[model samples]
Target: MNTPGTLYLIPTVLADDTAAQVLPPQVAERVAALSYFLVENARTARRFIKSVAPQQVIEELSLTVIDKDSTEAQIQAALHPVAAGQDAGVLSEAGCPGIADPGAELARRAHQLGLRVVPLVGPSSLLLALMASGMNGQSFAFHGYLPIERPRRVAALKQLEKQAISQHQTQLFIETPYRNQQLLDDLLATLQPGTRLCVAASLTAPTEYVRTDTIAGWRKQGAPQLHKQPAVFLIGA
Candidate 1:
């Protein structure tokens, strides 16, 4: 029986045009050695590979898209090459794979198949924001995205705030880039006055911004224009 090849979990840059500064040299080296990749988007993955390993022939690489809509059969098929003893890499559209990304399912299946799974070091916007937030790093929760409707979102915010205060844990969450400003407004209005809030935007990029302030302070200072900019939000006591 042939031994299964390793499944590499590769992290992509958090922000555009910042791969050189954030991704370590070893990440590129590992990516350069892989010929098969499972990615959320083939176009962006190809672009990232080209930027990191310019000498790599994009045409020669095989990229399989494994997104939210991908099925169990599709995921198993994507790993066929690795199961047959050919190393493969999994790349997320942003940040680390399997962290609020579809790559989680792929990694789970890889483990069930007895394939070796390795994760390379790279920029993770969530971790970066948490590190700079001055909140509870020892214990925290990441809620991928809040509800779109105002009423439900507000209720969710209140619940998260209560959890943060009662358990002494940090509540981390994100919103669609375009809805960032609206989310901030809701946070300031729904959360208690003294509840600490952290808004980290465009992380690892030239226009990066990170600030931690109470809801009252944020209301007094005025909300930053966060429309269309990727951001992470955290709330804690």
Candidate 2:
């Protein structure tokens, strides 16, 4: 019986300079060693690898595309190399894979096929936000993105707030970069005045912004320009 090769859940930088600022050298080392990779974006993955290993032959690497909406058959095909004893990597567009990423499907399939799953240490905007939010870090949840519809979105926000207030769990979520300011507006209008909101924007970037304040406090300061900026938001006790 052939022992299955490993599947590495690799994390990419959250921002342009994070390779130098936040990532350890081992991240590039491990990625460079793998010949097969499943990535959210081939261009970005190739760019990232090239940034870290200029000497690497980017043209020779086998890169497969996988996103949040990939199917089961697609996931199985991506992991086939791992089952055949070739170490493979799964890379998300940013941050760690298999958490909130579609690359998670590959990891799960790898496990079912008796492949070794290895996760590398790297920046996770969600965890970073929780760490600096001063909220209930020990107990928290990441809801990804709330509903797009106004009524449903408001309902979802209310539910998350209720959880935060009653269970003391931090409720974390994100919005489309373009709709970030709109989301903030909805958050302020929907959540209770006393509820705490942490807005962490452009994480690991030059223009990073992380602030925790009550909904009322936020309204007083006027709206921030979060449109088109990568951000993470948390609401909780």
Expressed as tens digits, the lDDT of each residue in 166-199 for candidate 2 is: 9999999998899998899899999888999999
lDDT of 1 at 85: 98
| lDDT (C-alpha) at residue 186 in model 1 | 94
- Which residue pairs collide in model 1, if any? none
Model 1 stretches astray by more than 4 angstroms: none
| Residue-by-residue lDDT tens digits, candidate 1, 1-237 | 888899999999988898889989999999999999999999999999999989899999999999999999999999998999999999999999999999999999999999999999998889999999999999999999988999999999999999999999999999989999999999998989999999999999999999999999998999999999999999999
Most lDDT-accurate candidate:
1
Model 2: clashing residue pairs? none
lDDT of residue 6 for candidate 1:
95
What does the lDDT come to for candidate 2?
0.89
